[model samples]
Target: MFAYYLNKTLMHIFYKNAALTDYLKSINIQQTSIGFVPTMGALHQGHLSLMERSMLENEITVVSIFVNPTQFNNLEDLAKYPRTLDEDVKKIESLNPKIIIFAPNVEDIYDGKPSSESFDFDGLENQMEGKFRPGHFNGVGTVVQRLFEIVKPTNAYFGEKDFQQLQIIKKMVAKKNMGINVIGCQIFREPNKLAMSSRNELMSPNEKQEASLIYETLLNAKEKFETNSAHAVTDYVQKTFKKNTDFKLEYFQIADEVTLLPCLRKNKNKKYRAFIAVFINKIRLIDTISLN
Candidate 1:
């Protein structure tokens, strides 16, 4: 019961915007360094890795667990996106009881209007995941910028699992001159090498196990990329998926990391990474690997 009472009394969670602001005022955070980690809240080991780093690096860590509605392109997706607040809180508290959680409702975040705000993330708004999802980054920019405005964190954390999204957030911070350091943490994966994602919760045990092929394929493609043409590497990946027959391959491209454009040939001086999106039934999974 000491632990229970400790959690009940010491846990710092804010569900309302005004309450959080008032609490921040009381604490006078001008001197404290805050690290922010935002998530849609299907707490996995992957999410914890980011939180763990934040807890170690800063005086205060704010982990926001809201499923931003604007980022989803479909109502079906928005409705189905996992929200595991109670479990998420448990996982976070396991690391450190003092960590702050900003888990606001739509009204708390957007004043109940629930519309997206747009930002220019250079040409990054037009590439890779942007080409497929359409306005997904605008919605991402909208919510992240609003969170930055609200939390005023000195530094923020993101995982490299969503590599394109990572690039976009960096661009948004630069364009706005937000002065906050956005740290991109390494991708966390399962024992099978599948990148951990909230969507993995939607898959069955067999499907989740089978999804490991996606990363394995990317690894093979990376090896092939050393001697093969970029076109040849993608074609090899395309055919590999065709052999599987269960996974619906969306798009696979090897691109320059900074420009976010497909690299037809190696420049030798520049770095590149392979990005892929695949579907296991209705669930979509994305992963990236450094090719160079």
Candidate 2:
């Protein structure tokens, strides 16, 4: 009973928009570092981890849950993405956060003028998941820039599961002289090693069970990379993926964690990351693992 009451009280504390901005200004934020975690609604433990980290490390934290339609390359997928703001609000309020939760509707956020600023690179946004879903990264850049403008956080947290997205955002930040510190958090996975994602909510009971294959394949690739040569690792990954005829493989590549450029050989000199994307009945699922 007491817990329920506390939850309600905390929920009421979250101020929206101008009120939130006023509250932040009312408080002297000088030297009180701000941390931001931007996401589309459908809060899960993965998102909570980012929030918890931000709380631990910063004096103030803001979490934005705007399901930016522009980021969705597919209109159907955008329409289908889940929204549980009431539950999500309850979830974040429990943290007693000095956090501003931004939950804006589509029209409220964008003017429908297809963001004029689009990002381009030689290979960063052209391969792997980018190759599979064209123009997806443009949507990412657009919404991220919007969030940066709204929150103006001192540091932002991003998960490594979206390795390419993370890299692209960092590049965008640097290219534009945004000056905001972007921290890439290690991907949070389940006990079975499946990377946590909002889309996981879309999985059926049977699909969830079979979905473990994505993580298993990544784990297999990691093992092969450590002991076997690059050629052997590539061959094993291809063959293992072929066994899972039920799923359509997107792209699986090992790349540097920092630069995100493809890594061919296993070496201790630098950290490596393994990225994978697959489709289970047209629902795209992505996961990553550590190679080093």
What are the TM-scores, per candidate, against the unseen true structure? Answer: 0.96, 0.88
Reference-based lDDT, each prediction: 0.88, 0.77
| Residue ranges of candidate 2 with Cα displaced over 4 Å | 1-7, 10-19, 112-116, 121-123, 264-270
lDDT of 1 by residue, 150-199 (tens): 88888899999898899999988988999999999999998889999999
- Error (Å) of candidate 2 at residue 145 is 1.1
Predicted structure 2, TM vs. truth: 0.88
Taking the candidates one at a time, how many backbone clashes does each contain? 0, 0
Q: Best by TM-score, which number? A: 1
50-80 per-residue lDDT for model 2 (tens digits): 8989988888888888887766778999888
Off by over 4 Å in 1: 1-9
Tell me how many residue pairs clash in candidate 2: 0
